[model samples]
Target: MFATRRADLVLILVALIWGSSYLSAKTATAALPVLAVLFARYAISALACGALIGLRRRPRRWTRDEVRSGSVLGITQAVVLAVETYGVAHTSAANAGLIISLTIVLTPLLDRREGRRLPPAFFVAAGLCVLAVGLLTSSTGLHAPRLGDALMLAAAVIRAGHVALVGRLTVGRPVNPLHLTTVQTVVGTALFLPLATPHLPELAHSSATTWYQLVYLALFCSVFAFLAQTWAVQGTSASRASLLLGTEPIWAVAIGISLGGERLTVWTTLGAALMIAGTYWGQAVERAHRTSTPMEESLRSCRTARADGAARRPGAVVASSPARSSSRSRGDTT
Candidate 1:
C-alpha cells in the first residue's frame, strides 16, 4: 500500500514536471533562438544521461536493437520537440499544454496493433475533443487558429505518431530504456549541432535565469521525469500510472495562470473544462476497448455473424462459441 502511494506521488510529480515544461521551454526560447534552446536542452540531457550511465555499478553494452531503435526514435523525437518548442514560442504555455493533450486520444488511433476496432462511443469522445480544440483555438472569436496553436496541433499529431512508433519498435524487443534514452539524447544533440552552430555564442551568453530554464527543461523535464515515471509505472498498473500522468494539462494550466500570469477568458475556461472532460472520457473508452475480454470479443463476432446471416436469410440465428478464459496484460513506458 505504501509503495503504491509512493508510486502514485512520483507519477504525479512527473506529470507536474512535464506540465511545467512548456513554460520553461517558452522562457528559454525567449532568451535564445528556438534551435539554440533545443540544442542546449538536448546537449545537457545527453551529458546527464552519459554521466548517469557511467555511474552505474555494472555497465552493460548497448544491444544492436537498442541502438537501432534509439537512433530512429531519437530522430523522430527531435522532430517532435523541435515543432513543440517552436509552437510554444508563439503561444501561451497553457494553450500549448492543453493542445498537446490531444495526444492522449490520437495515440490509440495511430497504434492499431491489437487490430480491435474501438467502439463508436470512442469516436464520439474524439469528436468532443475536436470540439474542445475548436473552442480552445478560437477563444477570442471564430477566426483561424493562431500559428502557435496550429503548430501545437501539428506537434500533437506528430507526437502521437512517435509514441505509436515507440510501441511498435520497442515491444517484444529487449531494449534497455536507459540506454535507449541515452542514445536518443546523443542523437538529438548531434542532429541539432549544425543547425544551432551560428547561435552558439548567443546561447553561451544567455542570462542565468535563461540557463536555469534550459537546465530545468533538460534535467527535470526530460531525464528526471522519464526515470521517475519508469520507476513509478513499474510499481503500479498502467491504467493507474496513466491516470496520474494525465493530470499534466491541469498542472500546466495552473502553473501558467499562477506563475506565468496567463489568463483564461470565459471561452477558454470552457474550452479547458471540455478538454479535460474529453480527454478523460476518451482515455476511459480506449482503455476499456483495449481491455475487452474474450467473451466480449466473442459476443462482437457473434453479432457480426448474426447480422451477416440475417442479411442472407429471412430469419437466421448465429451462436457464438464458448469463449476461452485468457489473461491479457498491458505495459507502458515514457
Candidate 2:
C-alpha cells in the first residue's frame, strides 16, 4: 500500500510537471525560436537521461531489435514533440493544454484498431470529447480555427500514435524504457539542431529568465517527468496511470491563466471542463474493466468447484448406503 501511494504521488507529480511544461515552453519560445527551444530542451534531456543510464549497475547491452525499435520510436517521438512545441508557441498555453487531452480518447481508439476492443463507455467518452472540442472551437464564434489549435490537434493525434506504438513495440520485448527515452531525446536533439542553427546565437543574447525556463523544461518537464512516469506506471495499473497523468491539462490551464497571463472565457472554461471530465471518465471505464476482470474469474472458478463437488455427492451416498453394502457382501460370497 505504501508503495502504491508512492507511485501514485510520483505520477501526480509527473502530471503537475507536465502541466507546467506548456507555460515553460511558451515562455522559452517567446524569446527563442521554436526549434531552438526544442533543441535545447532535448539536448539537456538527452544528457540527463544518459547520466541516468550510466547509473544502472551491470547495465545490459542493447539488442539489435531494441536498437531498431528505439530508433523507430525515437523518430516518431521527435515528430510528436516538434509539432507540439510549435503548436504551443503559436497558441495560448491554455488552448494547448486543453486540446492535447484528445490523446486520452485517441489512444484507446488506436488500440482498438490494433485488435483490442473497448467498452461502450469508451464511445460515450469519445462523444463527450467531441462536444468539448466544439465548445472550445466556438469560443471565438466558430470562425476559422487558430493555426496553433490545429497544430495541437494534430499533435494529439500523433501523440496517440506514439503511445500506441510504444505499447505495441515494447510489449513482450526486452527493450528498456530508460534506454528508449535516452535514444529518443538524442534523436530529437539531432533532428532539431539544424533547424535551430540560425537561432543558436540568440541563446547567448537571451535573458536569464528565458534560460531558466528552458532549463525547467529540459530537466523537470522532460527528464524527471519521464523517469517518474515510467517508474510509476511499472508499479501501478495502466488505467490508474492514465487517470493520474490526465490531470496535466488542468495544471496547464491553471498555470496559463495564473502565470502566463492568458485569459479564459466562460466558453473556454466549459470546454476545458468537459474535456477533462471526458478524459477522466474514459480512463475510469478502462480501470473498471481491469479491476473487475479478476473478480469475475474468481467467481467463475468458485462456481465450477461447487458444481464438481455436487457431481461427486451421489457416488459418495451410494457407497455408504445399506443396499450397496448388501450387494457387495453377496458378490464376495459368490
Candidate 3:
C-alpha cells in the first residue's frame, strides 16, 4: 500500500509538471516560434537524458531494434508536442490543458480496438468526457471550434495513440526506458531542428527570462517528468497512472485562472468538472477490472475442481462396492 501511494505521488508530480508546462509553453511560444520552442525543449531534454545515461556504469546500447522502435515512438511523441505547442499558442493555456484531458478517454478506446474489453462503466465515463469536451468547445457559442481547440483535440487523439503504441511495442521486449527516452528526445529534436533553424540565431540574443523558461520546460517538464512517470508507471497499474496524471487539466485550469489571467465561466466550470469526473470513473473501472482478474481465475479453478469431483464420485462408489463384496466372500470361506 505504501508503494502504491508512493507511485501515486510520483505520478501526481508528473501531472503537476505537465500542468505547469502549459504556462511555460505559452510563455516560450509567445516570444519564439512554436517549432523553435519545441526544438530548444527537446534539445535540452536530450542532453539531460544523455547525462543521466552516462551516470550509469554500463549504459544500454542503442540497438537496431531500439532504434526502430524508438524512432516510431519518438516521431509520434514529436507530433503530439508539435500539435500541442501550436494549439496552446492560439488558445488559452487553460483551454489547452483541459481539452488535452481527452487523452484519458481516448486511450481505452484504442485499447479496446486492440482486443481489450472494457466494462460498461467505461462507456459511460467516455460519454461524459465527450459531453464535457463538447461543452468546453462550444462555450463561446454553438459554433465551430476555434483552431487551437481543434488542434488540441487532435493532439489528444495522437497522444492516446502514442500511449497505445508504447504498450504494444514494449509488451514482450526488453526495452530500456532511459535509452528509449534518450532516443526519443534526440529524434524529437531532429524533427524540429529544421523548422526552428530560422530562430536559432535569436536564441542567443533572447533575454535570460526566455532562456529560463526554456530550461524549466526542458528539465522539469520533459526530462524529469518523463523519467519519473516511466519509473512510476512500471510499479503501478496503467489505470492508476492515468488517474493520477489525469489531474493535469485541473491544475491547468487552476493555474490558468489564477496566474495566466484567464477567466472562468459556468460552462467552463461544468465542463471541467465533468471531464475530471469521467476520467476518474473510467480509471476506477479499469482498476476494478485489474483487481478482479485473479478472483476470476480462482473461481474458474474452483468450478473445474467441483466438476472433476462429481465426475469421479459414481466410479469410486462402484469400485469400492466390488472390493467390499470380495472381502465379505473371503471372510465367509475362512
Candidate 4:
C-alpha cells in the first residue's frame, strides 16, 4: 500500500517535470535546433538511468539477456520521444499538448488494429469526434496540420501503441526497472546521435547561459524526471500516471501564460477544454473495461489490481518472460 502511494506520488512528480518541460523546450530550442535538444535529453536520460542502476541496486552481474531486452524497450521509447520533442519545437505549446492528449483516444484504436474489440464506449468514433473538435477549435489556427503537427500526431499513435508495448515488455519480466531504463536511454541516444549531429564547436561558441539551460533540461526534465516516474509507475496505477502526464499541456500553457507572458485566448481555452475532456473520457473507458474483464478470460485483467501484490486473488501478470524478449510513431504534446 505504501509503495503504491509512493509510486503514485512519483508519477505526479513526473507529470510536473514533464509538464514544466514545454517551457524549457521552448527556451532551449531558441538557441538549439529541434534535433539538438532531443539529443541532449536522451543523452542525459541515459546517463541518469545508468547512475541510478549503479548507485541504488548493486547487482552482482547483469545478464546478457537483460541487456538485450532493455535495449529493445529503450529504442522504442527513444524513437517515440525523439519525434515528439522535435515536433514540439515546431508547434505551439497549446497545440502540442492538446494533440498529444489525443493519445488516450488512440489506445483503443490501436487495440482494434491488434484484433481486440474495445468496448463501444471506448468508441473510436466518439474520441475522434471530440479530438477533431478540439483541433478544429484550436486558436493556433487550423492550418492543414503542418509537418510538425503531423509528426506529432504520428508520435501520439506511437505513444499509445507503447502502452501495450510496455505491458508486453514488462510482463512476466522482473528485470530491474533501472537496468531496463538505462539500456533504453543508451540505445535511444545512440540511435539519435547520427541525426542529432552534436557539434562541440557550436556548443563552445554558444554563450554560458545556453549551456545552463541545457543542464536544466538534461538534469531536471530528463534525468530526475525519468527516475521519479519509473519508480512511481511501479507502485501506482499506470492509468492514473498516464492521465496526469497526458494533461501536461495544461501545465505548459499555464507556465507559459503566467511566467513566459503568453496569452490564453478563447480558441486555445476551448480547444484545451475539449482535449482534456477527451482524455479523461478515454481514461474512464479504460477503467470500466478493466473492472468488467474476468481474470480467466484475459491476462490483462491484472491491471485492475493494486501494485503492491494484493492483486485480486489471481495473478494475471504471472506469466513466463524470456530473459529474453524481442521487441512506433511519433507525437508532440501540449
True-structure Cα RMSD, model 3: 8.2
Model 1, span 82-167: residue lDDT tens: 99999999999999999999999999999998887888888898888888888888767767899999999999999999999999
Reference-based TM-score of each model: 0.89, 0.84, 0.85, 0.76
Candidate 4 residues lying further than 4 Å off, grouped into runs, are 1-9, 111-116, 124-142, 234-243, 295-334
Model 3 reaches what TM-score against the true structure?
0.85
The list of candidate 3 runs beyond 4 A from truth reads 1-8, 233-241, 293-298, 305-334
lDDT of 3 by residue, 38-133 (tens): 999999999998899889997666677677788899999999999999999988888889889888778877865335478888889988988887
**Residue 279 lDDT (model 2):** 86
What number of clashing residue pairs does each candidate have, in the order they appear? Answer: 0, 0, 0, 13
Each prediction's Cα lDDT score? 0.92, 0.85, 0.85, 0.67
Q: Which one is best on TM-score?
A: 1
- Taking the tens digit of each residue's C-alpha lDDT, what string does model 4 give over 152-212? 7778888878766776666676576667667777887887778777664565576777777
> How do all the candidates rank in terms of lDDT, highest first?
1, 3, 2, 4
**lDDT over C-alpha atoms for residue 280 of model 2:** 86
